[model samples]
Target: MGVVEADEADRPVSSIVLIEPANRADLPAIVSILARETLLGVRDSADPGAFPDYERAFEEIVADPRTTLYVARLEGQVVGTFQLIFFRALLRHGALLAHAEAVQVDPEVRGHGVGRAMMDFAIAEARRRGAGSLQLASNKQRLDAHRFYERAGFEKRLDGFKIDLSGH
Candidate 1:
């Protein structure tokens, strides 16, 4: 039930308004946004309902204690989505870290500050949860996204690696 209300009075156009936790009905829209991404498109299902595994994954995400999937609504349209996962660590003074993943903004509303708003909410949420740090990983090819994350006050300090078995 976490939500962030947007101030449309300060903007030229009032497209984005409410940001809330994504529910089952939002799966199609979320998948659509993911499908539009150049890097994730190959991994996300083309037809939103074609993947039953996604439904299972959603169910698992729901059962998890430290995970949240959020979608941004722009005038009743689901235009953006991101997932936040909190991690418990024995290091760093046993601090809990909030990790954001699979963030996507619809192409039709890319420049309307929707992505910025989502990141702001994520940071706020991490603060609310008392997480020691917030972090995320974006593909090296997504230079534009890297710039965006930087603008959101994220520093590229540590290097991350991943072994892709899916060949995406």
Candidate 2:
């Protein structure tokens, strides 16, 4: 609800960390971390660059006021990143909607609450931007992530089906 602050004593071993928008300088690290996370536990995955081109994508997001990209920092090291995109519909009057995606966390800090802090920051930021609702679709295989979202007070809105529009 309120601001989440990382305690100084918890540094290294434990830290609360702060979440802020990703800058141009942080793109390389962000991309590298995402590549690693995406490849983990997969036997025959596609190329590492299969994910969104964070450098270019982030630039566009930064240029647009309707979108936000955030990175979680602890002890001056980025541990996680996520993005929030605000959408508006003319029929909905002044209501705003936010969609979150590309959530990735460093494996070394999995249980240290870095992910939770990032999600909380995203939620707060969305609310601050006057978003009437927030939505996120997690992959079905990410059961742990599903639990994490539920623990954060998000209820399952759908079974999260997908259609492969990427025709080869």
Candidate 3:
């Protein structure tokens, strides 16, 4: 995708955000954003020792045909990141569903429309790929994030549930 200039009346006139497929070099910035800016920060690490694991995970994500890791860059600096995964769901009559995860925007750029641009890109990509709908689950504790999503046109339609399997 090409760069999207922030034209919202409330956004800075000079902001130009680019959303693109993440490469190996972007992993560090991506990891930093996730570890420092999100609700999952406590569970994520930006330590050197943790990087190899992130690298491996990045490789795996890119290798999977149905998944993609994307980064939002402002003037060549990574400022946001998200992962989009597509899957066919039996419950929706085998509809193609796009699930977005790990969406994080650097605090410095929060009000600059970077997140909006990223969500716009995600929605367009999902539609282009024939997905019936795009869905995402934000942790219940993230009230601000929920508001952001709602502002992006996502509705709180269904209650989401999860189970930790790391102990198994």
Candidate 4:
């Protein structure tokens, strides 16, 4: 909501971070951030040749009314991103569920409250959307991410599993 100030010892800087729905033009930066900042970079790429595929995927995601891809901008530069999906769940008496994925913040801005602000934005957005809960899964090997999520008030109540359909 306000400009986040980095610790003086870490980096004496402050800037307003705004999280909003991403546009087509933001895809390149978004892809670059994902590839450069996350462990999933092995599967994600920022190559110029990869733009076509990313563009197609972005089109489909934006077409869906229940889904939104968001970007966090710091001083007008793309610095972070996350995707949020809203769905109805039968388990919680037909409650609306918000699933957040692909959250990443540039390494250059780590520990500057960018991630925290992005997460806080996600939580607020979920609530504003009338979601009963906001849920996300972090890679088991991402211990730092786990700690960050915990600090954000998320609980480790269940284990998560996935099967790679790509069959790589």
Candidate 5:
């Protein structure tokens, strides 16, 4: 999950590259990555071709001060994405907290450090934004993902359970 320096600063960075506050133009690629991963995990996800109208969501998030999206690019192709949502909580000295959600790396880019780079960027972004704490949720069955998070200094501190509301 560590960043590997390139021979030239201007040269294309390898494995993992992070770009923050992705625009609506990036949603199609991000949706593709999510759909692919969801299919691999056997989750009832929307079809890649039917990812819906994300123009409004993207515009809203990009315009909002409390939200950000980090896109992982490999060899100039967007291969993964994650979102950070910031909120204020009274318990933490009235400081901002950031939560990372919907993290996904393309199957082709998995194990190549893309996910790690994206997370590293998110953590730095949270710090830059004056967030007092950074958190993320991972499913219990994703052992590999959990291990990766652990290696990156995350701890399994909370258990979250949920039931679907879509009534599928």
Candidate 6:
């Protein structure tokens, strides 16, 4: 789904456009932002051309109805990106849950509320989709990100465990 909305802050806020299902053209910028994260950066190439497999994966994700790859733009330039996945589970009364992943904002615009707008969009979209909850998982090393999420109204509700099946 495609959408555009003005900043709704009662106080002044910078302009940011959140696009659901981010297009292929935004890949390079998205990669750049992902490369800025201390933990994720070590595993990222930052240059999309270096990874053909990512292109294939991106295509698959784009075709999947349950996922949306969001790209945040400012002044027509892509600055941030994330993936939101919708799932239904027996828990929460089988309500659909919105899970966000790989959220990243350009280092150049880190303190400009760009991440806030992206997250606001994710939360709003989850509500729009009748989701029971909106959630995201941050790396244990991302203390700053945890603080940011808390400031954005997220809580430390559960402990998450993951198996490294990728074996990287």
What TM-score would candidate 5 get against the native?
0.82
List runs of model 5 lying over 4 Å from the truth: 1-16, 39-49
Candidate 5, residue 106: Cα displacement in angstroms equals: 0.5
Give the C-alpha miss distance for residue 16 in model 3, angstroms: 0.9
Instruction: Please provide, for model 1 over 29-98, each residue's C-alpha lDDT reduced to its tens digit, 9 standing for 90 to 100.
Output: 8887887787644666658367687788888888898998889987778989899999989989899999
Best by lDDT: 3
Candidate 3, residue 33: CA error in Å?
Answer: 0.3
- Give per-candidate clash totals: 0, 2, 0, 0, 0, 0
Name the runs in model 1 displaced over 4 angstroms: 1-13, 39-41
User: Which regions of candidate 3 deviate over 4 angstroms?
Assistant: 38-41
Q: How do all the candidates rank in terms of lDDT, highest first?
A: 3, 4, 1, 6, 2, 5
Clashing pairs in 2: 6-16, 10-14
Q: How many backbone clashes does candidate 6 have?
A: 0
Candidate 5 per-residue C-alpha lDDT over 12-119 given as tens digits, one digit per residue, 9 for 90 to 100: 454336555666778888777776775346552346444554655677778887777778766668877888999999986788999999889888867767676777
- Superior candidate under lDDT, 2 versus 6: 6
Where does model 2 exceed 4 Å of error? 1-3, 6-14, 39-53, 90-94
Query: What is candidate 2's lDDT per residue for 1-168, written digit by digit as tens?
Result: 223564343234355577888888887777766767654363222255743555566778899988778888877888888888998866568678898988888888876778878778888878888888888998877889989899877899887677968573
Per-residue lDDT over 101-131 for candidate 3, one digit per residue giving the tens place of the 0 to 100 score: 9899988888788888899899999999999
lDDT of each: 0.83, 0.76, 0.90, 0.85, 0.74, 0.80
* lDDT for position 24 in model 1: 97
Summed over model 4, clashes come to 0
Q: Candidate 3 or 5, higher lDDT?
A: 3
Q: Per-residue error at 12 for model 3, in Å?
A: 2.1
- Stretch of 10 with least lDDT, candidate 5: 1-10
User: Is 3 or 4 the stronger prediction by lDDT?
Assistant: 3
**What TM-score, to 2 decimals, does candidate 1 have?**
0.89
Q: Evaluate candidate 6 by giving its C-alpha RMSD to the native, one decimal.
A: 2.7
